[model samples]
Target: MKISLKKTDLFVGIYLLSAVMFFIISIPSWLLDFLLAFNLSVALIVLFNALFAKEVLDMASYPTILLFTTIFRIGLNVSSTKLILRDGDAGKVVLTFGQFVGGGNLVIGIIIFIIIIIIQFIVINKGSERVAEVTARFTLDAMAGKQMAIDSDLNTGAITDKEAAEKRKKLQQENAFFGSMDGATKYVKGDATAGLIITGINLVGGIVMGMLYSGLTVNEALNKYTILTIGDGLSSQIPSLLISLATGILVTKASSDGELGDEIVGQLFSIDKVLMMVGAALVVMGLFTPLPNYIYIPLGIALIVVGRRLKKRTGVEAIEEEVEESEAEAQEIRKPENVVNLLNVDPIELEFGYGIIPLADVNQGGDLLDRVVMIRRQVALELGAVVPIIRLRDNIQLNPNQYIIKIKGIQVSDGEILFDHYMAMNPGYVEEEITGIPTFEPSFHLPAIWITESQRERAESLGYTVVDPPSIIATHLTEIIRQHISELLTRQDVSNLINNIKDNNQALIDELVPKLLGIGEIQKVLQNLLSEGISIRDLVTIFETLADHASVTRDTDILTEYVRQSLKRAISGKYFPSNETTSVVTLDPNIEQEIMSSVKNTEQGSYLSLDPERTKKIMASTGSELKKLEDMGKNPIVITSPIVRLYFKKLAVDYYKDIIVISYNEVESNVELQSVGMVTA
Candidate 1:
């Protein structure tokens, strides 16, 4: 179970509520007074500590602060009592000070709260050095999921698996070493500023609590300590100064973050030694017959300076150690070349297609504007033609007179041939010419003449086999027409063409493949096309239509049946049928018998045939849809029967042509046009 921030906040709320209710309700009246004062001062401090400690020492920070505060407060209480019991003069001064500062107990409790707050702040406010480490860790954790997501998407056919895997692998490998570097960097940028701010806030709160408690109680307890002098007030605050100085130094030392077991100069000096020095000095001053009130100021300032210097020195050394460690770890991650290679290349494939186009110099109104330019340089080796594929820039429109032609993708020589030479021979179209010259029987023709030889030769070699009348102007027109159609039959165009074909002759789809492959140069271009994400089946459909236009096929019953079956598969969205069974439920004998009984009961020796039942269903769906158009004041033909679907498919080509024109006009005018208007137009 992943822990969320919301959960953490909820836990904190629960902890706070439990603490407030239990501690406040259970204590005796007198004890409760003391506990209330203590809890009030410490509540915010403890909460801050809880929040900060999570970052400081993996849960240890919180418990450590709690333990230290308890011990220190108790020790302060003991010392205050000893002074009051042993020396009348000191006792008088101490009592007066304690009462004025909200009593000895309140003062001590407040100080402890301040100390914990400061410690937590220091821990939480760690600097930028750690940010990189955190980012790196986050990156590493995210990589595996990202890679898996890519794999799942690809395997499920949402995208190509190879592409997804490769992209993810690249990112993961690049950032593998980043995490280590980040960890070391963050360790050196300890929480000094954060610790200081926390300490400052706690110090202010402690001061306010101490002042309120002491000021209020001091007058009441004043007569108890007759020996109390003006100087006692100043002298009494020495411990607070000493504690703050000691804490600041301690926080700085903690920030150093050296080796877990490394011996430091501060470690040698020891917390015990530091405490003993302060304790002995205080005791000696107290034992004196006449203690100077200003004695603590110098001592407090000295201790602060000493602590600050110590922290500064140790911190620098710790940072150096961290930097060296990072460099060393980075070195270890450098595996032998082969091991590195394993994680280097992603499992993704980026099929190289046409090169980038130069659009800056293109003129929107020029003849070249409507022409598609394909960069054949990369896949040029597979095609016989110079241009491998076509891509038209913006500001170009398809010619209304042009019809798209596509050749089935077949591997061909030089990657430029219109169709595969080997497949072209399959339909008995290849033969010796009548003029005793070895030439293609279906010679390339065009409706225009005076066009450059480059265009004519390109069209012929690519299998355009332009067949134009002998008139020069006719040849030029034919060439121009073929070129315009070629430009329009780009990858996008071919896809739309296949969709239209599939809508009509789905049964003959398999046979359509060979015929489409018979179109010139399309087969040669298929390899380059795979990268563009054109499906093999759709590509075959486009080629088939082009082949059909070039060589009209006679209507045959066998071909018609094939077309129908293909259409059914398409309508049902069954692209690839498989023999493998994926469902795991086993058939029960009793259920099987029951199913057979049901079937036998329903069986009336009636065979399923094309009839009114099926036709009625189609009509209900289609006619209802057509009625919707009519309600909207649109004139749409209602063709429900399969026979009518066939007739419309052949004859309704002009209907779609008109629809496209109306759509174009609406777009040009930037006005919303109703489908009814479009249909009527």
Candidate 2:
């Protein structure tokens, strides 16, 4: 049988093997030298990797690497201590370090080793551990908000599903990596403590062994054993210091597009004025103080030269590069495929002319974008549907004060507003007229005037409803969206809605979706409800109703009527108070009979086929009654028999768009109804 191991497996095997070898009684001097060298090389590699990594996830395994290297260093400390206790010399590496680096002074070597430990354990390691903890906490706290943003982007078509998934995965990995680092920092702290304890043991144990067992004198034993113990401590502590520094760099470094070294250099020297000021200050100090001219003058002059060169390069070269990049982007935009991308349309778009730009700019105190996001949230709560992002842009072809609202590339409404003026509407009881440019409110087409800022208080004193430019636009956009919501509900949106509730209602969804009724069929039912201004927020009830009657009727209009009857309370509460009587217009019995008689049923659906003359009479009567109800300050609702409700709605929709048509079945038992007017034919 052949045995094959992957790279990761082989690396793990080598690590375990090395861990076991640290327990051996004796290690050769040459092997001890090799281990010390390997420790230093690993520390250097870790530092470079941390400094150059483009993203945190790119160094996902850094915590593991840190743990393994720390263990290896501690093992080396143990093995070298054993060697020193057995003999005066630990190895060539330790001996050279003690004699050359410390000048063969035991006190100097011991002091140097103590300083290294203090810096690593008290300063670098402590700070890195704190940073790791804070970073991990912040990453976890922001994870939910970031995930929601990704979902919003995907729903708005700003990003694809795959891209959203990748971003979510990267975010999760980053959280995990930082969390691991939080725990791994403790390893470094412990390793430092262990090193200190081991060095103390080596010094005491080496002294006792030399005097009592080898028969050396007190002074002689002190000199020989102390030197060897200091050497062993310095050899292990130096690499420990390097590894600790690397951990500090990894945790404290900010994210950047380039390497850490390049970022440090570029940012530090980017401002030429600062460098010039520093150079001038240095030159002044050199002249006023006893500093050598040979050292300070040349350094100052070199700084001044470099500052001038950087200033010229950044100013001229940066502009040229920007111009080139813009030209390249323009060329790419002119390509056929890029132009074709413009053919894709937003579900809702708001376009304005150049004069209204300040209304959308946040720096100018405009809150249009903020208002738009709030509008989306409000609509979702009210309508029980996710509103796609509305794309806003400027169109130079339009008049400076003109704005247009579009749905799916077709303009639905257009108006002009004075950006610098306020709209003051006479609330049907204003005692005085305000002197200004005469206009009408864009949303409701109510008569209004655009008054100056000085007239705002005067208009309000006269009971006029005054609004700013943003409020006017926001109100108009809201009304437009409310009117066209039916067109916005797609199969994908229905799927999202179902998926959102799947965790709690999995069985209901499994029974109703793609089995009893397809998603497209369900979408049509929802659109029907939305078209009639009925909120489907109670989706559980809606799905249950469909599951009960979907097999009986395949017609969406009929199914929508069933859903409406099931949501009677929600519908009633929308137009009237729960305890108040619902005031509505009642169709004459003769007209109801005529409409019910003209209803034709086919494989397609049920519809009315009344004669032209009769249709005109019915529309004329309904319009007159609806106007009366509107004048009385009562919202107009038409009530008829359940069998003729759908047919009557079809007849009046084109002419009486504002009137809500409901059947007797849609009225709940808890509410009372009063006939405010009669639509007679």
Candidate 3:
């Protein structure tokens, strides 16, 4: 049989042995030497680990290790105290520490011991405790915001579910680790306090034992026992000080890719100019002031040499990197695969000029990526579809402040933004004018001015809507997405929607998809719905309606009208309050009869073949009625017969793109309708 032991078993055995050592009345000299050496080794190991660990969680067992090591130190203190009181000498470790560390003076030894205690108790331990407390509080406070960011990323498809779960787990562990460190600092404080008390007892008890039992004179007792007590105090307090320093380093360290030493070297000396300037200043001071030439002159010369070397090395590295990149690009251009790769294009792309780069760079405090993630989530909820990831890059050919938004390789919208200025838009009622650079708001084309950041408060007080540059871009992107969503829905997007519902509605999918309509046909219907800003979130009702109507007619437009009638309540609620009366424009009786007669049906599709003059007259009348509704601050909706609704919409789309045209069959009977005006020809 083989006997096996795990790390946990070894740790438990060590802890039990330490606990047993505390109760032993006396430890042999060899054992005393071993314990002292072991204590010093543990303290050094902890100190180095704290300094070199790349991540705080890498030392997740630090608090537990701190507790056990503290106990082991205390146990060693007890055993040493016993040896010193029983015999005139403890062990060679104690005696050697007394003479060498104290320089053969009891007062010097005591003062040194007290200084260590003060430094540990007042400075290192206290600072570590406070840092751990603040870190724990801040981590807990920001937990909600961090979790929201993770959720937004997940919903936007920026991260997979497993990656999100891992991030959340790490967040939880950070909170727990900081909380534990806060409590662990208390142990260090107690250990320091115990060291002070134990040192005092050893001094007094040793003196008493030397006079009463060991038959030594007063002078002899004072000399002998005071050195022994100070020695014992120094031995224990040195390790205590090391451990306290380690705790301070651990608590104060920030998140970084490398160890503390590497971070300090990289960041502190990254700038050669700063070193050169300091070196020059030091040389000047040494020559003018009373400072010794041996001190400042040598140091200044060394610094100057190092600065020049660093500058030279950095320049060489940059040139080498550029050369390598150029060669790689040249090679890539010759490859056949490179030409093939150019055939693919992003569904949506955002290109900005040089000055706008900071708005998307993470290191410059830009949150455009985060804003884009949030936009995707918002679009999903409102439009009932997941948007593809938007590719962003810089284009040098454009003006520095200009940005262009493109959909499927076609430019949809372009705008310019001032990076350091706030845009204040007139809300149509401000009496006083503010002086600034005049511009128009990109999203709605309203009159706006780019003002300094300091003017934000005054602009808000004047009832103007103030927006930042990133917000301007985000708003423009939102509007462009809403306008061009029809072009963005692809066959793959439709397939993703199907896969999402296949588990619960597999039978419905199998019956409707491919049997009644293929994916491409379904995609077209969805595009039609999205083009008019209709949500396809209710896909179950849509597919069922299609199943009922597909057998009767294979025409997508005719089938779409049937689907719209089935979604009458949703359509009505979008335009008006639920169960509330809506005011709308209606065509004149004669005009409706003429439009009905001119409709031409063919094998391909249906279209209006009205004379050009008659078409112009109908459009002119509709425009006039729309203007009247706008003057009353009302959005006008045109209600027409179901047969002419699509044809009328096709005619009005060019000039009245903002107006909504719905069929009578698409309005629910529960909704009350009032006629606001009439369109006559």
Best model per lDDT: 3
**Superposed Cα deviation of residue 387, candidate 1 (Å):** 28
Q: Rate the local accuracy (lDDT) of all candidates.
A: 0.35, 0.86, 0.86
Minimal lDDT window, size 10, model 3: 151-160
Clashes of 2: 0
Model 1 misses residue 122 by how many Å? Answer: 12
How does residue 217 of candidate 2 score in lDDT?
86
In model 1, where is the ten-residue run with the lowest total lDDT?
A: 658-667
* Structural similarity to truth (TM-score) of each candidate: 0.21, 0.82, 0.64
Decide which is better by lDDT, 1 or 3: 3
- Stretches of model 2 off by over 4 angstroms after superposition: 1-36, 55-57, 60-96, 121-194, 197-217, 268-339, 420-438, 448-467, 501-516
lDDT of 3 by residue, 152-200 (tens): 5664456877998999999999989999998999999999999889988
Candidate 2: what lDDT?
0.86
Ordering by TM-score: 2, 3, 1
Please report the TM-score between candidate 1 and the true structure.
0.21
Q: In model 1, state the lDDT of residue 605.
A: 28
lDDT of 2 by residue, 366-420 (tens): 6676677667888889998778778778899999988999999999998899988
